[model samples]
Target: MRIAVLMTNTDESDFSNSWPKDGEKFPAMMRRVRPEWEYVVYSVKDGVFPEVLTGIEGVLITGSPHSVNSGDAWVERLFGLIREIYAAGIPMFGACFGHQAIAKALGGDVAANPKGWVFGLVEKRFADGRSLPLYASHSEQVTKMPKGAEVIASGPDCDVAGFVMGRGVMTTQYHPEMEPAFIAALVEHLADELPSDVTERARASLVKEADMQAMAERIALFIEGQSA
Candidate 1:
């Protein structure tokens, strides 16, 4: 089994390159999860997705600085690929922009987040108490779930933090792979792009290293379970 992570460059002209960019964060986190499947990074900016994703066991799309609603041609193309992957019965997991894209691809809407942006660690309620390692580094969130979606997580600020669609696809508004060091680096790197107040809170959350590890283990299980 193999997991292909669809990555688009965060520095795309329209978006802000705040959080470590797709290249840095996605690879490092995939290593930590150690999905039973070998992991491959398919860069959209480099024109690899349509070819690289072929024959892959499963797919994971990382968060991006760009918005799905931006109407970028690449985003539209990627959205089509996501639909194909879902129709093929392959499991797909999405984070941040990835999450938003998944939602939009499945007949949902993505917006600029009128409430501003959500940054730092948040306590997300898993109705089943199943959420692990809660962290986020985005300004946009999923307001309405995609058609026929079942929400798995929610919080005060965001109505939809995580959701499951069809049989094998899942998308989370929060960053399950985020660690203390990663979060620290992400916040420090994006101090300017992010709201001024959340910087301190983001740093404070990373202090709890154990929680981050526990969260990573949960995600690993979820990713591996797909192969099983």
Candidate 2:
């Protein structure tokens, strides 16, 4: 499958060797789920994207450091592009920033969590009685949903941790692309951006192996238009 990976942010400046760029992270994790998938990455934060979505069967939007409400020109352009993709009936999957972006662009609301940053590993509970501990690192969440949006799963702190729109789009506020070690490294990288106590808890929550396989398969299922 040929997938368009819309990478919304660059890697942290201080830690070059500790981890890969945000764009690299997704493909690495996704290849385990769909090894045949070929990715074409666009740096959305740097204003890079295809002129059109022609021939792209699936679209994957990566997490970013920017907020969905930031109103940057690139973000505006991306919102418009998302509409185009949806209009064309292409399947799309979104991660952290992508989740909030998809929600906001589709007429939902995103805001700071009243409970504060929900960093580290979190158990997201699905309506079907299944729970998965996935890596999370976000302060904002989709509060009000857009038309046709359905919440499939949620966490204690973030209600709309996972959602879907029709069969064409699926999103999660957690990072399926991020491994536990990477989350720990990122916790240190983003120490100044969050409270020290939050960072400390995030550090403590790195014990579990991230339940990434199921989430990765979920994205692949959504992209391939199959049952979840």
Candidate 3:
């Protein structure tokens, strides 16, 4: 099986010294979860999309610093691609920015979170009512839900923390692929932009452990299960 990863982040947001780009990081993370599958990346922000969706059994779109409302041409183009992927009936998974993108493409709206940036250790509630603390990093969130979106997970600040759409489409607001070190470096990179109090709380929460492997496995199961 093969999965195409649509990388949306162009620059590393000044974290070059310590963290790898999303494209470089996703494959390594996914491979650890499902080593048998082939993973190919495309720079979607650079307007590179899969010319041929045929034979691409599954898909994963990574998070980005860019917002769904950025009005960048590439983001618009990706919205079209998301629809195509869903129509094509391929199992799809989205992370962070990718989650918001999917929502917007499907008729939802995104706006700046009034509660401000959500950075680290949020307890996300699934539709069934189970909750777990996961690393989080975003200022904006989904304000209005899209038509037909089944919200599977939510946060107090981010109502649509995770959801499942039509045709095996699964998405989450947090980065299942990000390591603790990567999150730390990201916090440092955007400290100047993020509010001081937000960073302080985020840093304090970082001392606690997050099960990166477990998150990876959950995502893997959603993708690999598509084969059956």
Candidate 4:
């Protein structure tokens, strides 16, 4: 599969520089499931995008530190590109901020969590009764589902933890690309920004293993036109 990875992260901190970028992080996780797949990355945060989508088989939007509601020019352009991609009937998957952006771009709503930030490992319960542990790091969520979108997963803090629109689009509020060690490092990096209790709890949650491979397989299946 040839996929277009839209990297939306804009962090320039020392921690960000020390770690693998979203472009690298996402492909690393995905290549585990589809070793033969090829990825083309675009730093959409910097206003970079493909001039045409002629050969792109799939699109994957990575998480970003910026919010979808930020009203930036590049964000608006990305939304326009998302609509164009949907109109062209290409399969797309988005994580975290990407998730919120897809929802908002498709006539849904996103807002700050009433209960505040939901960080660390979280268990998402699907309607099929399957639960998966995934790492989360976001302050906002999809408060309203887009028309025709189905809620596939939910968690205690987020009602729309994951959703799907037809066969071509899927999104998740959590970060499956993020591993335990990465989340640990992220929590430490944000120690001064996050609440003490939240940081402590996030640290405590790392002991539980995340279902990264399972989520990756599910995403891969969806993008490949199979039931995920």
Q: Rank the candidates by lDDT, best first.
A: 4, 2, 3, 1
Write candidate 2's Cα lDDT for 163-189 as tens digits.
988987889998888877778778888
TM-score for predicted model 4 compared with the true structure: 0.98
The model with the greatest lDDT is: 4
TM-score of 2: 0.95
Question: Model 4 segments beyond 4 Å from truth?
Answer: none
Q: Please identify model 1 stretches exceeding 4 Å from their true place.
A: 12-28, 33-36, 52-54, 210-217, 223-228
Order of all candidates by TM-score, from best down to worst? 4, 2, 3, 1
lDDT of 3 by residue, 1-228 (tens): 788999998664445534777887778887777788898899999889999899898888998878889898999999999989888888888888988888888788889999888997777778777676678888888877778888888886888898887556888898877788878877777789878998888888888756667667777777766421
Per-residue lDDT for 1-228 in model 1, tens only?
677878864565322443455655655666665634476777875566756446787677887677788777788888899888888877788877888999999888777667776777777777687545577767777777777898888864787888887556777787766656666666787789767777877777665542545555555566556421
List the candidate 3 regions with Cα displacement exceeding 4 Å: 226-228
Which numbered prediction scores highest in TM-score against the true structure? 4
TM-score of each: 0.83, 0.95, 0.92, 0.98
- Shift of residue 79 alpha carbon in model 1, Å: 0.5
What's the lDDT of the predicted structure labeled candidate 1?
0.71
